[model samples]
Target: MRRSPDLHLPQATRASAGNLPAFLAACAVAVPVLLAVSAGNIADPIVRYDDYPALLAQPEGFWQKTLTEGRWLNYLWHLRGVVTPAWLNFVLFQILWGVTAAAIAAAAIPPGNRKWFAAVLALTLLPAPPVFLMAPWSSTLIPGFAVLALFAGLALVLSQRALRLLLPVFTLLAFTAYTTFPLILLAVCLISTRQRSLPDLAGLLVLFGASFAGAVLAVYALNWQVHGVFGIPLDPARSPDPAQDLAELWSHLPLLQETLSVLLGKLSFQSTPVLLFHLGLLIAATAVLLRRQPLEALYLWTALWAGMALMTLQVLKLGVTIPVRAFHFTWILYAVLIVRAAQELSRSPGLPGRLARNAVLLVALSYLVQTAVQFTRFRDWQHETRAMAAAISAQPGPVYATGSILDHPAARKAGLHRASSLELLTGLQLSQCGAVPEACAHLPPRLSSPAPEPQPQARLERFEGANVLVFPPRQ
Candidate 1:
């Protein structure tokens, strides 16, 4: 493999300013404060979405099921009545994992490119786009977690240390069942190639693989006990068929065009600079790749494909089907490739590496600044939503809002008892109780119902005639 020439370390005082360990430590400190502040603003008692609702409604049983059945293994097993507290805890841990992954990816960069790598990773984590504008926050958070797991696994595989060799296996098993297949392929590829030591790689492979396989067996056993089935069957409605999902993805081609136009179209001081910044980098990268090579060519191809896949989903009306944050893994990998290419070109005596590095830094920095600004804005808006939820909770009569079309679990998670769009509850009831909507009308108005041991103190009542009341949360 080709490598870069090392410039002598600067004086200790100068080196301190650019220290990787200190920089990462600072990042560690900053990320939690940022996450805490962000969470504080958005973590209202009101249900923002369904996952939270399920966790709050059924905590203990949920945790029990997740531990036994595996993540994504038992969700459909018990249906809505089953809560997955373990999954929530998994999510919280995954978020922390994401921070660690980002730090690792930043660290893997050459010392000189550390700042730019950090910038690129940050931008990937928090992009400003229509998806960010429209999707639920969990949408962002879930994929963000998945992406972290994916990249961390990659880093571990590449590092080839004994401890690191087993990293991908645990990460894949801990995150999701569906994602493990590709990751296994990655592990086997690295192991078989003798890219790293065989003993260490094979040992970790068996250890982690056995653990994952054992978890699967345990989940299968649980399913047999619960529903008399040895397999955890996919829900027909929710099962993923690549062809179908791809078609569903293609339907949003027009929206993709619009979003592209938005990103590349124009920028005002008030508008997000994300589009402009990325576009500039795209151009610069194109220029750098004018001469392709084994290393340079592969990096170019990977980056292109990643971008295309992301943009294709956006265009297909899927509206960012893949988490934008997750795309950072590809971004970081390609960034490494770019640095490598620059190193190769600069060593040839004619071209100035410093000038190229400075130029790349400028472009990368612009994108980084734009991404930070976008994250701050998102944080601000989410704060408003939390405030709104609290204000609504504080009111006497059931509060309504255009937000009522919210995913049911969000309400449940928020600890709100009021039903928005009785249709949702009605459907859920029908699914659970196998009762028809028409049958409800046949029942007496004063039908007796069991009362709760502890009555709910307040609820934002929702009904068909109610108007959704959405207001900015109090400052």
Candidate 2:
């Protein structure tokens, strides 16, 4: 038989082919469980922040808003009527994410390597501090959409017999779900098309263009339906100046550094060694690939650049305080690179290959250990938060909360804030029998205090038919 042209792919035997589905099913279950464990206290009340209040307050209106905002399909999963207890709904969504990720791995990885690929992907999904797993706001779903879009796009470009038709459909779905995901899909398609024949590249480009245009048209139509025929909101504020945006991006360079640190699993001094070790392995693997498979190296580099470009654009558009979750595309790319590198090393023989493979395994294990520790700490924090909420709930009458659990040592250590915790408390205390209440007191922002001033202690004090809850600074 003629040798297959693709160096990375191995031929599938009959036994391996039969086992793929079972393996994928196992991965689908295992990944979400692992992620939930990492999240700590999965059964804890659904945390909330930002747009979550609106969603809880008005389910029907929220559904309508989603439809009018061009993300109508998200409502299929987000409908409050179908899924009770928002935490359970989040778990189900996470399971779907795992399934989608596994499907992509199955298409891209050869049968012999599927198990390893799945494990790496699962580890990548574990909640790192700052990159929270909860989707309190609509934009938080962007990472999940981006992952599915990239993988589906890769399957379309790499697999000859996979669901080629569905890839474009998936890409379009991701595009409508979040504005940023389409760019990721486009990047993947572009990189994948680089190795194809001229005709094949042209066809793929045409498909991508059509999908992009379709997504834009759909959004415009939705906007028109929600607003007027103008399809544009009438905001009185002046448009952001491009020059000022660029300057702001420059000023927020440290945010990018912090994002990279979190993505690399370097949240503390202890994890620093592991991060360095992984970086060294990545460098070695990149060198080997560049020497042996220049095209593949170029493809990886292009994907990394694409992710960075997307992040940079976000910082410029949204201002300097970019959320850690926004780096999901870049994080995904890093995981892919590390996993692919390890796989490539596995193909080699002799002492050097063994050492490289062992190093990769060690790094992965270290990441897991670190995550477990963080999860344990987070669990304790959740216990404390629940207790605090309970105490506040027992107090009768109107309540006003100031200061955030973000000020707590545990929360700060976990790189989380009280926003979600406070919101969850409000929802629980104010809502009746799992239903959103009509009106509730809003928590005020922490007041700015001068340095050296003693931080106020957290207390629930009664004040004439009303109560005030304050989160004291950590001792």
Candidate No. with top TM-score: 2
What TM-score against the true fold does each predicted structure earn?
A: 0.47, 0.70
What would the per-residue lDDT of candidate 2 be over residues 250-333, giving only the tens digit for each residue? 766665666555555533324676557656766887887677556566666666675576666644554443445455555445
Off by over 4 Å in 1: 1-48, 54-98, 111-164, 177-328, 339-364, 372-475
Clash counts for all predictions: 18, 2
Provide the lowest-lDDT 10-residue window in model 2. Answer: 431-440
Ten-residue region with minimum lDDT total, candidate 1 = 425-434
**Over the stretch 1-475, how does candidate 1's per-residue lDDT look in tens digits?**
7553334533333333444453364356435543443343233211223334343343433444343334442233224454434334333533544354344434333344455444444333322232222223342134334444454434423433443545445544443432232232332223222233446445554655555556567667766776677854543433223334766666656565655454443232244574455446555555555553343343345434534553464345424333332233334443444444454345545655665556555544454365334434434333444454554445434323322222323333333333332322222221111123343332222221112223222223333433223221112
Alpha-carbon RMSD to native, per candidate: 11.4, 7.0
Model 2 TM-score, all chains together: 0.70
- In model 1, state the lDDT of residue 269: 27
